[model samples]
Target: MMGEDADMRTMLAPPMSTPHDAGRRDLEQRYQRVCDLFPDQRVEIVNGRIVIREVPTLDHNRMIFRLLLQIMAFADQRGWTACNDIKLFLGTQVDRYRPDITVVPAEPRMWDAENVYADQTLLVVEVVSPSSRDDDNLLKPHSCSLAGVPLYLVIDPLEKTARLLSQPGRSGYVQQDAVMLGELLLLPDPWDLKLDTGKFLN
Candidate 1:
């Protein structure tokens, strides 16, 4: 038999959470530990804390569906792939963020084997909720900018508006356009995609 330390190492080798390590693990360890625990749930690591929110509302999922269709079509045209509900890890420099949708390269990388890295992230779309307003707006823009994510689109159905930010830099995106419902947002090249908001208005 191995020593107690070696036994502990072998026990926690896989990412299945146990009752013992529930309360005192660090942020990074906690994040990895919950990977498979909530396989069918929406779990996120926010500000060094693990958060589990209620299942998204129908309207939320509907908005996500509409935007996802657009992104998928756009990516298909460019021969790229769009994944929904993927966690975009920005390394230790920035915390993790689970966007409603993320557009990435066709090929996978080591970093993306589990969580998709921000460097591989081309575009991210977030459908805002009342509970997540600050996160979807303030926190995400700051982190995505710091991580060099090219485009960050925030859609707020409650506000009947959308905010598009680009040109990520240390301070944040240099350009920002606040688009009202029904107004078209033409994403910059190389995607050059146009987002329609008519349905979101009605």
Candidate 2:
């Protein structure tokens, strides 16, 4: 997606808001201050707290790379865009989240090199690490849904499972599919990319 196209679509998307909780606000402020100090660090505000996990394992990194390669190739063929480890600002309280993978349709804002917002994202993918499984599997999905991201993909190597979530409701996805190895998962709207679960496990 191009930057200009994304900007136009963002105008139609819901506006970002701050979390209602006081604790969330306090943590958001702290996170912003820290981000200012260390712009290289990947951080996020989850469950009203500022949490930072280490870079993923070698296997995890390989998996992400492979996924991105595949997704990017396919997206390019279809004139779409795929980004990896990009910070998505969902709201004031939830400023920066580094999803392992994100896909957006061709739009100018999507091409913007400066800022990457959640509203620009059509799909958010979380490849679970041992240290980040809980947050990725539960909290992040709910947060992305609340932000109105269309699709959420949870890839868990530990369990060798891939779950596709869509139809976002107030809390999270109203529809979800747990796809095991050898099964294909379908994404919702915008792109509706189909992913083979078996390829994700290795």
Candidate 3:
């Protein structure tokens, strides 16, 4: 069963108390300070909103580790690598995300020292947390699609399923496919890789 900590991790901060634009910079600065104070947590600006997240649970980290192991060799063969927690700029200054796993070139030409543009990513993945169901299934896919990320994967342990979104369009991904955790998920085109979801831990 889901726990209270999971719910707390997904809590969205209230809207900025000050006026828009006029206080955006200040708000960002304050959030930056919070990040500096708590180095272990993740603080993100999502479409100009501040979203703070606690460190991943042990189960969460294990899932990411398994994915990295499977993806590393394939990515290395093509001069690409898989990573996590790297800030990704989503076509705007105030919109950024740190996907659970990202497939990127070994030597990415970054947008900045601390960020990589979403367009530079070959794929992004997010493992669903209890309170993040909607954001993981919808908001992030839409944003990543608009930012031209080639593929987006959403793994929901609660549902024991994985959903892959691809064929990006102005609105969002043009195509989507889903399968149970025990099935193989085929990545189309350029990737041509199959993920053995049977190994994923729920």
Which candidate has the highest TM-score of all?
Answer: 3
Ranking by TM-score: 3, 1, 2
| Model 3 RMSD in angstroms | 13.8
* Model 1, C-alpha of 91: deviation from truth (Å): 1.4
| Model 2 segments more than 4 A misplaced | 1-26, 36-38, 108-115
Kindly list the per-residue Cα lDDT of model 3 for residues 78-124, writing each as its tens digit.
Answer: 99878777888785335668788888887776888878888888889
Alpha-carbon TM-score of each model against the true structure: 0.82, 0.77, 0.84
Stretches of candidate 3 exceeding 4 Å from the true structure: 1-20
Worst 10 residues of 2 by lDDT: 108-117
Residue 23 miss distance in model 1 (angstroms): 12
**Tens digits of per-residue lDDT for model 1 on 5-69?**
89899887988766544543566677677866887777787766777656788888888887876
Number of colliding residue pairs in model 3: 0
TM-score of 2: 0.77
lDDT of each: 0.79, 0.75, 0.81
> lDDT (0-100) at residue 195 of candidate 1?
86
Q: What is the C-alpha RMSD of each candidate to the true structure, in Å?
A: 7.6, 10.1, 13.8
Shift in Å, residue 164, candidate 2: 0.5
Report the number of backbone clashes for model 2.
16
Per-residue lDDT tens digits for candidate 2, residues 50-143, read 7776767788888887677657776788676777756776776564577878887677263236346666677888888888899999888888
